[model samples]
Target: MDPTFLSAVQLAALVRGGKIGALELLDHFIGRAERLDSRINAIVVRDFDRARQRARALDNQADKSAPLFGVPATVKESFDVAGLPTTRGHAALKDATVRVSTLPVRRLEAAGAVIFGKTNVPVDLADWQSYNPVYGVTSNPWSTAHTPGGSSGGSAAALAAGLTGFEMGTDIGGSIRVPAHFCGVFGHKPSWGLLPNYGDPATSSAAGTDIACLGPMSRSAADLQAGLEILAGPDPDETALTLNLPAPRATALKGLRAAVWADQAGIAADPETTAAMLALADALEREGAIVSRSARPALDPLDAYHLYLKLLDAAWSGRLTEETLASRRRDLARLKDSDQSADAVMLRMTDVPHRLWLGLNEQRFRLRRAWTAFFREWDVLLCPAFATAALPHRQDGNTWERRITVGGREIAYNDLLFWPGLTGGYHLPATVAPIAATQAGLPLGVQIAGPIHGDRTTIGAAALIEQALGGFKPPPGW
Candidate 1:
């Protein structure tokens, strides 16, 4: 087997057993990536020589204290890696100076992980599919005709293609998990604020923002947990910072309570997707999990999602040119007759009064409380990762207006948000479990969510379910 195709855990075991040197493992992946990355366009920048040097250094020390010791991984282009161009997929940044590494990246490096290359992302990290003029588009390993979800698409695609063993990706809205789903890989969107978002090269000129988070995308759930353990916590110099997350109980799944809402009123899942989720539910029930088919973890997720969108818009609003703002003002004025004017939408959020923002936070608080209560009875919740399987690359400028077929029905492009928004809006922890392949051979995943701080249960349950239903299958061509 190719060393590059080994799971992070498996690779770690090899390193411990002296079956392969870390530098030798690095060479295996580097050689493969050099040859194959051109086809997928998953890697944006190459740091092969430097990565080899670091791998050799780690081999000299061979310390086992670091959880990720000697493991090779990639960072999304959006994250800074001091001295590497942090071109969040923008051509204008090609010649820009590299910024310092983010805390997440720093933690990974501190843990003895070799920082390889940066993966491609959509321009400005706004799109769900990774593509930009700088690095071209990243294709799904399963089918080049389809896309690996983005802006972490490159990371997901690279992992799926065996170009890299693991990667660090950012998730504000399905950026991490969606790509993982599309690529038939593993991803974890941690509880909001669990991982630091600092170290963005784009924010080098400005202070860091917190709406987004940095997480791990890998081939197995355990790797996500390992990365999270390395990256989760407050920054240094904080007078009082303590993070003590609990490990999952060793209890069997037979009696575990699970609330399932595979279908939602907001969006329709594809026939194959629906079937897959149902199959997973059945599997869990047979495994001793007390599946609750009646209860659905409900929130006005649409409204919460809208709020998240508004805040996200505000975060990026500063980058809007003056001319765009002027046009938006006119658009807002004309939208007076309608409730949702594009201009008013952007302007209203930018100028959201303290009271209004407070009210929004209160609503978010209430929703979190409701979920907290729901989790009290249910050990886990199962949902869809996206409305459809990986679709053909879309060039349309409006992701919201895009449409996809699900269950032989047409669904608005934004309908994908309904499922992702459910967990993201509350900053809860969720894992994507690959259960089956679509008729077209695309992978379909079910997003398993657990209460905030219940990251262990979410991942633990996924591991059990993955074992029950056969786990990852090697891509046909790979």
Candidate 2:
């Protein structure tokens, strides 16, 4: 087996046993990166010399039993890495915004993990595909013509290609989960504020500060846990809240009540995706987990998706100029009598008043309360991560309306946001687990959503699911 393809857990064990030096592991991954990264475009900027020096130092250290000690990891370029430029995939800001190495980066460094390089992201970390002028585009390891998903696209691609043990990325919308879904890896978006998002240049905006979350994306659930342990904590600068809670323990998998809401009556999931989720449910059932197929409390996936868009848009509202806001207000004024669609609601959010936003915030709280009550009867949720498998790469972000065929029916392109938006509504924790692959050889992932602040619960269940159904499968041509 290739050492670069070793899981973080395996690498930690190897380091502790002294069977292979941490420096050797770094060298192995670095060499693999040099060989494969050019085709995948996963790594945007690399610092192999610094990583080798640090790995050498870690090899000499006495305390090598840490969970991620000396493991090589990549960070999404949206996060600061000191010497590397934090472009956030925008070419213009390369000189203005310097990468100062945030708390998340520092924590990972403290854990004795070697930083090999930074991954690519969409421009300003806004799109679903990772492509920008700064570092070009990131291609999926499974298929070069498809996107790996963004803004964590590069992180997922790197992990899938065995370029690194694991990686860290920020998620506000579906940034973390979508990439994991597209790239066929494990990614966890912890409960709101579970991890710090401080010090990234992309997060410098006043409004951007409140909505974004930093989390882990890896090839295995264990790697996600390891990365989360290193990144979760209060901001050292006292400007952010602290969440230093211990990891939740799962004594066993038996008798754990889980909800199965693969597709609400309204949304149509692709046959391949629906089948993949059903297969996972069957596997979980055999694992001694009690599964319930119940109506999910009248959950409105489109509504939830729309609400998520509104909330996320508000987070970046400050970036809009007064003239732009006025123009949007004018646009909305002309549509006061028109019916609302998800797209219309998303467009209207730009001109929403403060009072209206306050009311929406209250409604969001009610939604959260409803989800809290719903979780009382369920411990985990198994659903689709996206509407389809990995999509072919398109630079203009205009491919979302191409009407892909599914289950003998055609669906709109942008409809991909609905399933993912379900978890975003209540600010719940979600884990993306790769279940199987499609007939076309593309990977399919299942999304596991849990109650707010119950990140470990979702992640723990995902870990068990991985054990029940064999974990990640390496992509060919890596």
Candidate 3:
């Protein structure tokens, strides 16, 4: 049986029913990756030998009830797989090997997933495009000229190219959702802290950062839900508490209240993206769901954008050297508070004072509360995932000077962070579900934002939308 387009859950069901052995599925995916990954460059590191052994061993078991049992998947390279280098695409760490697996990797393995390889990522997982000196670049399966969206670009590319069954990726600024949008897949950016980041090299600190989250990326919403079930919950050391994700608000689309925000004041989505969101809202209204096009949270878009930039930059400050921080501090001192340019905002937040960070944290909490109150009236908020579809490959090396064209107008590259940061900055749960395709066949998706800890609500809404409008259509020639 061809398992190319099957979801991880479907593959596991087949394995459990004895219709296909775990080893057979592993071999099928490995073969596909070997033959097709050269074009997209998604699967960068192969761990097929041990994965084969584990799959063969699993075939001998009778109880195969694990949600992802026997299914093959690839994880972002930033994640640690034992003995493999967990380089966040850094050339210096290219030969460095990890001694232990990350918590998510262990959890997924325990849930019967056959993780055969690691996917590509940008250097330090910082850019929206996934290209590094270590593993090269990953292209969108829809069109090689366009990127698959990074820092989880390779994971999305692999899934879209039929090279992997499922994937897990980290998201701070649309790393997971943008790729899902660009690749026409389903990706869930779970409620912050829902998934443990124990062993990932980037976030293995004593205290995890507030804005970043690790989540599941897959071709189907059901697979995303299944992956979240296996990966969510308290860390292994925090066994005193268990995670009980609340059930979705409602299973059916009807009776659900959805707020659609297709474009914000300063940010304009592509014409196709705007049309797709409006079309989705119209469809929801036709299906008996109450859709409001003008609804918005109490927070101001500019304030939220500044707050997100501050918190996101502060979260990443640990990576900067003392000299760099000192230089940035000097630069910040020379600038006035009126300077609201992207570089000025980033420089000011590079070395945030403890008290200032506390204030920002309080602001974030207030934003979360606003979202909570908004969700009390609206079950989900549908918005553009990004300003445009999969962007063309841009590798000029100077990211700060780079710009992206949206609706025929060039905007600062950082503007891409607006929509994702809207929910990400506030630590709310958001899911990306493909809604329509651009004129060139590039996929466009909408963000389903829900209340904090309302992960299942967003996923359920995406699933319902997916049911209404089909999800995860393979790219041509894939």
Among all candidates shown, the one with the greatest lDDT? 3
lDDT of 3 at 111: 95
C-alpha lDDT of candidate 2 relative to the true structure: 0.79
Candidate 1 positional error at 73, Å: 0.9
Q: lDDT per residue, candidate 1, 1-478, as tens digits? A: 5676777877877776778888998888888888887788898788888999988887788456577778888989988888788878778888786667877888998977888999989888877889988888889889999889898999999898888877989887788889988999888888887876666545553344435667888888778878878888886734368798878743576887877777766456777777888887788888888887768555665566666656656656666788877866665565554544222344556445668767776777788888898888788888888877897898787564476676777766655666776787777898887888988899988898898988888888777767777666668887
Order of quality (lDDT): 3, 2, 1
After superposition, which runs of candidate 3 have C-alpha atoms over 4 Å from their true positions?
A: 200-203, 326-339
Candidate 2 segments whose C-alpha is farther than 4 A from its true place = 95-99, 200-211, 239-250, 321-339, 397-412
Q: What is the lDDT of residue 392 in candidate 3?
A: 93
All predictions: root-mean-square deviation over Cα? 2.5, 2.6, 1.6
Residue-by-residue lDDT tens digits, candidate 2, 336-454 = 55635444566678767899989888878888887888887788888888878887876754433355554566565555667767776568889998888999999998888888888
lDDT of 3 at 380: 94
lDDT of model 1, residue 302: 54
Give the TM-score of each candidate: 0.93, 0.92, 0.97
lDDT on C-alpha atoms for all candidate structures: 0.79, 0.79, 0.89
Model 1 pairs whose backbones collide: 128-150, 254-288, 402-413
How many pairs collide in each candidate, listed in order?
3, 1, 0
Per-residue CA lDDT of candidate 3, range 1-478, in tens? Answer: 7889989999999999989999998999999988888999999999999999999999998889888999998999999888899878778887878877999999999999999999999888888899999999899999999999989999999999999888999999999999999999999998999998888454366577778999999989999899889999998786779887789997998899999998877775688888888999899989889999999999898898889988889888888888877877787778898867566677777655799999989988988888899999999999988888998999986565687788877777876788888889998999999889988999999999999899999999999999999988999997
Q: Give me the candidate number with maximum TM-score.
A: 3
